[model samples]
Target: MAISSAGYEGTVDEPQWSDLLANGGGRQYAVADAASWKVTAGTADREVRIAVGRGYGYGVRDVSDTVVSLTLPAPSSGSRYDLIVAHRDWQANVTTFTRIAGSSARSIPTRVQTPGTIDDQPIALVRVTAGQTQVTEIVDLRVVNGSLAFDELVLQYLNRLGTKVRIGVTEWDRDVDSVGNPVWNRTDVTPDTGWVEATRNGGWAFQYCQFRRVGAVIFYRIAAERTQGWGAGDNLAIIPAGFAPDVATYVASSSSRGQGREFVFQTNGSVDTAIASSGATNVTLIGSYVAPR
Candidate 1:
């Protein structure tokens, strides 16, 4: 085997199954943190389902969901068991669902004490009462994917839910790149894109107006007054590179002493303001909007 000095795949330094998985109460990632690739109740009583998700299970990336009806042997008086995983393992080339039996009390059941193969990735707990026909309850034991050493949100490993959640985000735009593959857009250091002042237009005077970019969002502050007639599409400022939103974003303000004004972010990176024809003075807005990449 070639020794990989750069932690690349197809070598000894390839990412492990635990790399994309997180723990429920385990601290491999953090102290008493979260779980990854979570499982939930299915349509049927005996069936539990895991939404289509992705993870490295055998040092290989696997994308799948679990919808199989688990075996339910009649409990003598009821047995308490922890569902160790969706852990893709065993010589049979299957995801082994090991039930570690323990206390029968109706509460958060105990998980495996020293689970590791890179530590145990538990999905949930299962308790079946004697003569029960279905799984009593499925406690949500999953948390943000923290199998890695960094924070999940900071690392951007999310997207482990929904149908075909391999690299797709339903609510987030620009998640997929030009080739449609999911990508992490953050850098090790967030650039300090400074703000720029807005230019006066159509007799409108700028008191304070500027915008800055931090990560994938753009924040701006505005304060201005109308000294003269301000038109509908007057440009205020130019949005910095990579900070303009896919769609136009807006901020509005109006005062009885001044006039109603709206700050519109144009796709061309120009910030425009539309003053109300029948309203009064000073407009001020302080907010942030997404700059999707």
Candidate 2:
């Protein structure tokens, strides 16, 4: 008797089990026939054995009252496969599975069952890492339609060395002396005043200056006016704290009556102006510096 490509078929009276046995493609024997197989299949236990010419094969057995195990033949170095197991008990709390490859055995997390859940699930094993884990890119920014928005994003590190640094944008007005200390007599002007020590001498009035900082660098733009007319005299402006110039020799550009002069930073963090021509009402200064932390 032979089993054809279409498979075996027979009536009850005719029978096909003998035909399957006679063909000898595979065989079923008592479990006791395999001396190395340690499983109790009871008195009626039988096992199907097949000769795999290549690749691998699996043997599953109910080992004991509380244990079931699946065995696989040893595989070659580059070979890989996926294995799946199902549990009929939905209330089981098993959250891990064991894998034995070559001489190495490891316990891996089972994905199907999570804590506080009672459901049978499927698990996927991605990759086994043996060294450092790395990622090339995490995010990309783009505009959708005509709008762009993000719920949360971190632009800077929280800590530098052991100190905390912050970044911000602000707009304010204040009056100060040569070292950047605020003078309480200043008023907030309509168009935004950036002056330090603004004062009036008889008919002439002057607005000191203003400065802004980014990181540890500071940039300043200041202006003063001779309300009635320009005059010849020295005016002083204080540099704010945290933005003082590194040296007194630092020079800033000062212009009056269409002519440019130089203002210098004094050792006390003040800027001393050059003589202003009589009737000259506009005096301005501009400069930048790297401030100390």
Candidate 3:
């Protein structure tokens, strides 16, 4: 509980400086979980498109890659799950991604990363059928989360937005109206769910933002000017704990042209969406999610 600034004058004794990443690769206290390193199906079935991405691994600002193609090994005599992962290896002093070949079984194995600096960001799962050269099923496993030095994003929401939230008088599990109307069976939760107006990476100025949570339902309408680092598929706001959905919650929001834009709320409180153009930095987020407790 000492009062000290983060990396003042690029000093090593100060707290890990997350805000000064570009300045001689400042320290990264949190493993960045953003979409900078996105992986998708490449031009060929055996190839994967790895977009240039940036990440922080083990107190060091890791890699940011340009789009490249990675060809995986051919399938063997038995079906197995080959995971495509992006990680920074401190032992080799390199930040890159590779294919981890699972055993001839079904279970997904853990990463064999260096224990000292293990930053494994799973990109996708390539299921290989026995005796096949080209892949058929490429499951997108990249989670559109973000980085936080010492959970600064968490502290921002806690210190700035902790107030009396609106609570539902009587939350419910089952609701029925007419004799033969639709009956709803919902999970039970109280005021334990809430959301904060959050942004990506570091600094971002907000405007006209409001968020609320009642029981298992959370609503948010926020807009912010992007003034700091941003990555593809990063979350804008993080939903509080105890209300994470079993699956990702999707909400279709109206675009400026009245078109629909999809937003996903993940189990780790990451509110995700498609990558916006670099020129379009002013972002407006509005949606609601019903948590499946």
lDDT tens digits, residue span 44-91, model 3: 747777666444433444444457677877664666677776665555
lDDT of each: 0.48, 0.32, 0.51
**In lDDT terms, how accurate is model 1?**
0.48
For every candidate in turn, the CA RMSD to the true structure comes to 14.6, 27.7, 20.7
* 1-293: candidate 2 lDDT, tens digit per residue: 11011111223122333332333223111111122122221212121112111110011111112322333333333332322222212244222222223222222233233312432211111122232122111121111111111111111111112221111221122245588664323121223224333222334344546666664456677666655543333545666654566665545345645245555665566666555545555656676765543
Top-lDDT candidate index: 3
Q: Could you tell me the lDDT of residue 159 within candidate 3? A: 19
For each candidate, give its TM-score against the true structure.
0.35, 0.28, 0.39
What local lDDT score does residue 133 receive in model 3, on the 0 to 100 scale?
Answer: 55
Clashing pairs in 1: 23-34, 35-143, 115-120, 116-119, 258-280, 258-281, 259-280, 259-281
* Candidate 1, 66-129: lDDT as tens digits: 4334554556675664453544332333334445454675433344333223223444566666
Kindly report the root-mean-square deviation of model 3 from the true structure over all alpha carbons. 20.7
Give the range of the ten consecutive residues with the poorest summed lDDT in model 1.
162-171
Runs in model 1 lying further than 4 Å from the true structure? 1-189, 194-203, 254-260, 279-281
